[model samples]
Target: MIIQAYNFLASWQLFPEKGEYQSGNRPKSGYYRINASDDKSRLNIEHTWVTLENDAFNATFSIIPDGELHDFENAVLADQFKASIADTSNLEISFYKNDRETLHVLHQITPNGLLKITQTGTAPAGEQFTNIEIYHKQMSVLPYAAAVSGAVIRPTEEGMIRHKALTAMEEQTNMQMDQIRRQIELLALQAREIVSRKELSMLIYNARLNFSPVIGQVYYLYEKKTGDHQVSMISPREWGNGSGPFKTFVAKVKLLADHTWVEVE
Candidate 1:
């Protein structure tokens, strides 16, 4: 189509396709993920990052010869590849391969409007960017779109992983906080129980005890008309309507060997 200008990133897998071997420690192609020790993991990452970058340099078909063609870089590279040319063209059998560092080759416009590859540089780093003219040419944006799939898709997938990790970390922190809260609540309850037990023991001990209270024995406590407190073996239920000087039923309790009193139901 008639091209004005365009630009795009690329995408490529660091892992290999099915049946692809990782024979030489260098992953065949694409991303590499392995569950191993730290040293081995680091090595794999180093290998993948380096080789992936190598592929990216080759797959990065948008490296126009010079900055002047920068605006139309997408247009220029798009015309050279087919819709199915997803990675560095060399990897596919339908095209040629160059193991050296080269993102894109030079091209010239023929009389018929086809852009021809005239300088697929020979050096390991490929040729220098020679100033060129790329004013009017028919190019397809669809092909360029496919060429940049590697640079475009990989980051998004990686971002998804980071996002999930963040979410998991946040959930873990929340659980920790919840556990701490539960512990605090339990401790507060225990503290209140201890205070209640001490107050009960003091009240029962100070009250008028007509006879010695035995350990592990049940008893009753009451407030007398003279405002004096009393401890007795008689239960509140047994204190018929108006038997003793009981002005108020205090609480039912039991005596422990430690001389402490515990409220009974």
Candidate 2:
């Protein structure tokens, strides 16, 4: 019975109930309709007192007994109507009495917790149908209907959760990259400042010695073998474990094709 209650409540929430009557047929404003023109929108019933004028009685009709999907099944109703919100609003109920029959109450919210009241002429007076069905939007088959009504195709227990996690990770990665870029720029500036001969020699011998901790220094000078000028910097952590092993930078400038000077700082 809870399933029935849940199904009925869900249907009432999803489908529109009767509002005020328009002309003699169209429902009033604020109703759920798959497709309604400016003149006609389906009505959703949240309160008991809704004016059912015009052809409001059409909602009172019972469904004829059918195979799998009767009015009770959302998917069945959707499929029988070709799964169209626009088209289903115009459809009447299709049911059968041979197996079971049901009639839906149009205006009144019945005590049965029924989305709409169901009347089965074939059932015993005290017997009530207990089967309730739950259905999800068929994305592939009912894309247009889902879009028009803003229906979730299939809700997952973890889809939203996973998406949030991935978003957070991406944000963290961007922050780390930004920090590294800043450090790189700082190192470049330090290298440019190590232009003096004394500073360059200290850097090459101490920082680049592989046994020193004098890091965060820059150096540059001429090199004989490579015959090219170079500038570089190093961090304390990059070369040595402590201050004794001074981590340093070295750069060499070429005086001639074969002559070079080393700078350390």
Candidate 3:
């Protein structure tokens, strides 16, 4: 996915000859502001404000950056300072990870297409920030469409098998997560108001550990204060092992729909 963010302030510039303030470049008397937008979220106009005097603005916005974005800014381009790229007039942002496009942002060819924000700058300490600023005079609107032609399609035996396994894994994981959540809720209810922090922590931890026990895994737990010294927790795959201590313990959960056990293994 190719993902990018572009922010611009709509402002009218005054020349030295037509100057209104002593600075000549930016007169305090003129009225100027910008309206910016993007995917992921919308900015409330009432919440958006720009400090004309500081040539800075604050607004609400969001972007879904590609996995490559982390690599681009952090790894390959680490040494480049934000000031060096602060003057970009326009930005063409594309995000891809492992050869798949995840997001794409194309700036319109309007006055707003002049500069892009790819650097970090200090702002007033208390402002909640979410977007970057860009400077441009013209922006061109690009046709927005999602492309999936490059995605790999599985057709071979191994590929089909792998796809089936992944589908099964996803379903199993979802089921396991739900079952674990319910178990945790029940255990929390039972352990509520426990005076000891250590006891509560152990209860929660054991509940989580048993929430989704693997098929072949054997879990061991013990406490010096408890009368029962040790416990051997086993899954269905370990059924062949001879029975040992039948301690007060929770069992691991099995999430696969194909399982026939009355309770999760």
- Model 3 C-alpha lDDT per residue in residues 80-103, reported as the tens digit of each score: 111111122333444344444333
Which residue runs of candidate 3 sit more than 4 Å off their true CA positions?
1-147, 151-158, 193-265
Give lDDT tens digits, candidate 1, residues 70-95: 22223322323221112221111111
Model 2 sits at a Cα RMSD from the real structure of 21.0
TM-score leader: 1
TM-score for each predicted model, relative to the true structure: 0.40, 0.19, 0.20
Please list the residue runs of candidate 2 whose C-alpha ends up more than 4 Å from where it truly belongs after superposition.
Answer: 1-155, 195-265
Q: Could you give me the TM-score of model 1 versus the true structure?
A: 0.40
The C-alpha local distance difference test score for the whole of candidate 2 amounts to 0.28
The best-first sequence of candidates by lDDT reads: 1, 3, 2
Best by lDDT: 1
Which segments of model 1 are wrong by more than 4 Å?
1-155, 241-243
The local distance difference test score of each candidate is: 0.41, 0.28, 0.31
Instruction: After the best TM-score superposition of candidate 2, give how far the Cα of residue 105 lies from its true spot, in angstroms.
Output: 43
